[model samples]
Target: MKLLLLKTLLQRRARDEGFTLPMVIALGFVMILLGMTNIVKSSEENLNAITQNSSSDALAVAEVGITKYRELLNQNRILTIYNDDQWNTNANVTGQACNDLTTTPTGWEDGGTATAPNDTTKWWELREDTDGDGTDELIGEYRLVSYQYDIDDDDFDSSTPPTNNNGQFSPSDDNANTTDDFTFNDVTYDPLGVIGTSNSPEGYNPTGILTVQGRSTDGSEAQIKVEIPLRINQNDLENLDPALWIGSTDTTYLANLNGNLGSLTVTDGNVVIIDAASAGSSGCSDPADGASYTVISDAREVPSISSIASKRTEAVNAGINNSIPVTSPAVLGKTDDDPYVTPPSGATFDEDIHCANISDCRYYYDLSATDITAVTETDGIAKVTLYVDGNLNINQDLGSNVSSSYLEIYVTNSGSITIDSDSTNTINALIHAPESQLTVNGTGTVKINGSVWVDKFVNNATVEIEPDTTRISSLNTAPSYKLYSTATARTPRPLTGSPTNWVREEVQ
Candidate 1:
């Protein structure tokens, strides 16, 4: 009986052993599968991290390109060979190359050819020290391509290919269509809305679209495009603040014992007097009326004579010396009879004069003689910046009308100015003579519709000297022609506002 029981037990134990062996093998296979799945997940995570890093690097390189372009504009180096009129030719790139920056622009190519001159090499390579060692590692590269953003169509893909082989990307680009192409087509834009009237779009040049293609070492690429518009610098005329500025600190009576005869109405500015502030300090009938100006003792110090003279010197250097010998009844600027007057000597008064209109405008005038009977801009509107070495005498009105003409008389050398116009007539001018005196001597009411900056002002006649808002606004219209070069005139608009004026976008 014992032998039979032992045999049965041995068979059962063998069966149990077979089942356990199969279970062990199955557990080993399941463990191997889980290890393989973990390995695959780790590989995918590493690949995703690498892709994300490349994308980030490409975007950083593209932003660097935009920064480089902005730096060029800030340096005022954009219009060295171009103007606002031919803004299309001033594009950073031409044709489809603007969108497809892999094919470089005309002026910026690899090993630049005759048709493409790479003055500033092609790629901006990015280098980094990945391992924190002394040597820098090459990370990525980027290139810049720009297009002219015309406000008329409001699109970015309208650039045409360059036509000429000059490789300068200039007037010969679009069949030599070098006319004033910056004017908008039926678009209404009110800048600042100060005048209430829709101003002419002469100074508001068209915008530019700058695209940057950034590539990482791992073949990852990205594109970024931004709008670069032209903007007027706010502090372009920082010196000309007060409407009527007196530089004299000497005790001079503004009123000649007659309680100050005429009126001096100021608008949109102050009447700063460096002299002692007393009752009737401004010498006006109503100093606090429609004119809200102050008469502080130390409001502002007078500008030096040399500083004012340097401005005249700068204008002379800029080929603005449209000079003539002052004679009685001699017209200085353009007239209806001779609208396009090319002077016999000195600089030529052509369409490039610094003014609102682009016709034959004469901005700088170096009058040889001192006396003058009449000065007028008979042809349309003109702005004159007259430099008088000797004493100036105005026997008649300086400008024709307030709206049509403007004048800035500079008498840097110690000289005086005598305004002897009729009471009914008006003298519209900005007189700046820090080392001289101004005498308004007329029996009738002579109105001066501009500002005055002199050492001393002697009002012997009935005169009203104040600056109107219209004239003040004209000083800011075209700042390239301003008397003070306080700041650069035109610059790329700041990255503000909506996508229309200035914006940034990522390209697919």
Candidate 2:
């Protein structure tokens, strides 16, 4: 009986051992499955990280393209005037970079076409030497998808509209209505017209918008829209506040003028009547009622002297450093004893400083001696900019022929500026002497055809001043002041929290 029990137990043990092998096999299989699952997940995570990195890179590349394009545009800007309005690159410009709109900087592809995205040639490869070993590694590529201008619909003249044929706005041929819909790259772009004239400084309206696509080597893409707004040219006198800007706040009868004020039918045209004190013995007449000139004693109208000085400094730095030494002979007899000429010493003035041949004609003076630096533009001169560090005396006619078209005088001292020329002389020049007092006491019927911005002004001379809008319009120079809109402030991107004004988005 005991032997039979042992056999039965052995059989049961054999069955139990067989069941253990199957369980172990099942466990091993389960472990293998988990390992495979983890491997797959790791691969997926790596791929996702790579894709995210590429997208980030593409976004950075898109921003870089915006900056690069802006730099190119600024460098290749060509503005044409139409009806006394500044039509920037977006307007009618011929034979220039803005002519075709397809022309780009050197090494940049011409992808301004409508199907720029499909064209592989339009891509500009972005490269950087990560190790700084000269051999640049390809980061990604970018393409200018579309460039369209936001025209001023209100400003468009239906009678004399500007033409835009094949992205070429011809100033010579005025045909196409600027407000009409223009097709570019198979897309009819609508005119995102200006806000208003009051908002625009000096009629500077918004230019246009640029769309660029940035693509990474991994096929990731990012698109950004960059708005190009109108930039204020500092040289353009239109940016100036008033025709005659007085920086002083002394309300003690500062003006004593009897000169006639007249304008060339400009926005703010008028004559002078500084009868607040007395016209003295000057033979000047006052303007009729409803004149165009402005008369405000508000201290808020005062412009900072530093701002005007900066403009003068900018011109000097831009290769206009022609020095007028003290030794230079003056047309008027220089009385060394009477450096401070309260009134004319009756000196015979017969000198003629002609600046017709020179282009810049910016003459600078650094005179330690208080001698009068007399200038008389007998011959028609180009845009002559004089930077006087001491006293300046204008005899005879000052830029009679050119008027305010090409004459600008910037005085940087408290010295006297004597206008001893007779009244027949037309002093057509823009004078900016914030620190000095301008004394207009010539005997002749002097006609001031330009603008004057001085600290203290004494109008004892019988004169006729017409605020020349041409003064600001004729000034076409560099070192401009870029006035951005409330939308885009000095940058292509929009301000935080004010996303409605400007549009910047990642389309891809």
Candidate 3:
């Protein structure tokens, strides 16, 4: 009965041990799978790190290489010439036998033996004759033996050959057939020469800047570049002080002016003052409004009588004014028969005279006249004093045949000079100093074909033109900048202490 109880205890112990075996196996399998996964992940991370490091190194090397190439191109010497002839025949081989032996040997037999007999007195002569004559004859003669020894066989088999008199393989011949026929076309041989290509990367433009120490074409050691930008602004225009922009809105004046009416000051007043003539009627007057004027102010100031008279004279002389009729010579001579009546010489006196021809009359100078007519010179200088009772007219023939001097016209103490021209008639005047302020006052028009350089001030000047037109242009344009690149070489040296690598960098 005790033995049976011990047997039941043993059976229960076996059942527990069965579950323990499966648990230990499962734990071992999980440990193995976890270890393998860790190993694979660690390997992948290591590989990725190595790849990143390699890419960085490669990028640096490529950049350096490109820079080095640029420097090489920029250098003075760039190309080297090994051979320049179209058909260079210079052989680069040495220790080459000239011909084949054994087959058609003059002194060599088919067997590995010499033709000279033993103990022969002419052995030296035979050897020499065989070496010289046999080589010449064998190479010069044509044969049809087999592809191995045949020079005429287009499809010569080089794999199989006879033991003797077989054609030997020559590296020089192979090089000649493969590489020696190279011909350079349109090649420029320059040392330190620059070359360009259109294969640049997008948005990556290369430019070179060279700071040379030697003298330049201007005989100065200066900084020169292929590219430069130029800018022009309002400051530059201000410095030049062109006449077109002078004193219109940029000038200041005195604040006050005293007058006879209780010493009238010009403070905050728009009226200007006109001084009276202390002498005679030689002074100017306001326009007739049927009122007897004692003194005149800026508000009553009017165009001078002299200016109007000058313009009238100019129009009459130019044959544009028909109101003033010119009488015939015979009629004028009859009226001036007395010759010494001496008409009253006043400011408004109209003197009538007779001339045999228009050239016989002298230039009239009356400051109160409407117009005066004159001619100019071919040499661009017109010198004429115009005293206008109305308007002034420059009716001068401008040429060397008419006038040999410059055209200089003066509007002397008169009204404005009006430059008028028809399609067939044109007037060019170079006005100089005037007694009063000169004005280009006219309802009629004037045009200048050439540039006018004004060295003096023009009061109340007006330049009328068609709307929206270009006023000026550059007579000579300036140059612009450009960019270029070149390549150069650096000295070859070891990259560290090792002889395997080299050091390359762009110096400039």
Per residue, candidate 3 scores C-alpha lDDT tens digits across 330-355 of 11111111111233456332234343
Q: Where does candidate 2 stray beyond 4 Å?
A: 1-17, 77-91, 95-103, 106-121, 135-137, 151-207, 228-508
Q: In order, what lDDT does every prediction score?
A: 0.47, 0.45, 0.24
Report RMSD for candidate 3.
39.6
Error of model 2, residue 306, in angstroms: 30
Per candidate, the number of residue pairs that clash is 1, 10, 61
- Which of the two, 1 or 3, has more lDDT? 1
Question: Which clashing pairs does model 1 show?
Answer: 423-445
Go through the candidates in order and give the C-alpha RMSD of each one to the true structure. 18.4, 22.9, 39.6
The true-versus-predicted C-alpha distance at residue 218 of model 2, in Å, is 3.9
TM-score of 2: 0.36
Over 4 Å off, model 1: 1-18, 76-121, 127-139, 157-205, 217-219, 232-508
Of 1 and 2, which scores higher on TM-score? 1
Most TM-score-accurate candidate: 1
**Stretches of model 3 off by over 4 angstroms after superposition:** 1-362, 367-385, 389-409, 418-425, 433-508
Ranking by TM-score: 1, 2, 3
